[model samples]
Structures are given as structure tokens and as C-alpha cells.
Target: MNITSTLVTCVDNWLQNLYTKMYSHHTETYENTVEVHVQETSSPLTKTLVLRILINEEHKQVHIPNIFIPLNFHRQGIGFGLIKEILKVANVYRYELFIVDMTPSFYDRLLNRNAQPAGYDAVRIDTTTRL
Candidate 1:
């Protein structure tokens, strides 16, 4: 998913968890979620950042459960790049449903970063339905 020189890859483990504690104020991990790892070509493993995206094939939807970029990696477009990758996968698999479980601040940031207008408003709670 490297749209540029920076290395963007998928990680199967928490080897970069140390960077989370050192660079973020929140230390909580998003358990049982798939992760997309980002890092510079010259950077070490500990310098990588984790972006979590949960895909539910039964619902044919994609979810952004967590987006955590290290403080040192902020303002470098890493977050946007990560989301771009997610969108690409969704488009390829014909999955248009998206859910962002994030704070207002991060939601605003996401909307400003190439997100389609009113996409969030398309979500419904399904109060009358029971599965």
C-alpha cells in the first residue's frame, strides 16, 4: 500500500507496541483487530505506527476501530495515507459501508482528509430490526 517511498505494510504481531507507550498519551491497545503498520524506509521496527481496521465480511462493511500515529510521526500524512489504503481495499471488494468509531476531533480530521461529504450521515441504528 505504499503510494510513496514510505513503507506501508500489514503486521501480524505487537512488536511495535513499545512505540505506542513512548509516543502516545493513551496506552490502551485495540485487542482482536487487524492492523496496518507504517514506517519510513530508514526507520527501525520500533518506529512504526499502527492503524487498526476491522473488516466484517458478513456485513460487507469496513470499520476504523483505531487510528494511532506516533507523536513523532504526526503532520506527515501517515494517517491519511493509512485511510487511503483502507478505502482502496473497500472499493476493490465492493464494500461501501464504513463505520468510524472515533472522537469528534478525529472524525473532523477524517472528514477533512479526502472523505466524501455526508458519508457519516448514511449510518442507521436499525432500532426496529432484530437479528
Candidate 2:
């Protein structure tokens, strides 16, 4: 018996609620889905923007890859809040996810920054906060 399927379904619904508020102007697709992608460049040299998807742990739930906020933007804390919001909700239901994947440039962007080194991977920055 896995509540994960149900859990993700619920999370997706809640996210859509917020997605509508934040991106109300931009029409969405793939019904009941809100995705986030973390890319490095604004308009990449290539047609595709490689985004890094990081999850802390997972029960193997389904999620759309649509949160496309560049890492540069995340460094400034834009879509980061949304990610945290979703992570907090997921944690509320007790679902843990881990870093899925990212491009080399994604790592390079952070390294290029003059800011103090958080680590080999700043993705370690946790989003799930307790109430």
C-alpha cells in the first residue's frame, strides 16, 4: 500500500493552485501539473536549456519537468521559493526526494560566483522547513 501515488497527486493539485497564481498570464499544459526547471543561461547557446532537478528523496512519484527557472535566477531566489513550497508540502506527507540530475554548466555557474563556497554542490541547500 503506497500513499505516494495519492500523495503526489495531492501535491500536484496544490502546486497547480499556486502555479495559477504566480504564472496566471502564461497558459499551462499537461493538466494538473506544475513543473520547474533550473537552467544556467537565460537563452542558452543551444535550443535546449539543461535544467538541474534536485529531489531530496523519492517514493518514485510522478512529477512534470516544467519549473524552468535559470540557476542564475535561483541564485537570486525566484523559483527557489516555489521549489521550497512544494518540498515542504511533500515533506508534510513524509515524502523525501534526492537530487535527480543537472548539467556541468549548472555547477560551473555557482562556482563562478565570488560568493563563499557552500560546497561541491549547493543543491544541498534544503527547502523543507517545519512549521
Cα error, residue 15 of model 1, in Å, equals 14
Candidate 2 global lDDT: 0.38
Candidate 1 CA-lDDT value: 0.46
Candidate 1 per-residue C-alpha lDDT over 1-131 given as tens digits, one digit per residue, 9 for 90 to 100: 32111112322223344334353322222432455554543446554436555556567666666667767657776555555555555665666534366676655654554354335432211112110
Q: Candidate 2, after superposition: displacement of residue 16 in Å? A: 11
Model 2, 50-126: lDDT tens digits are: 22232323343323233454333335454444545555555565654322233456545434432223345333223
Winner by TM-score:
1
lDDT of 2 at 110: 30
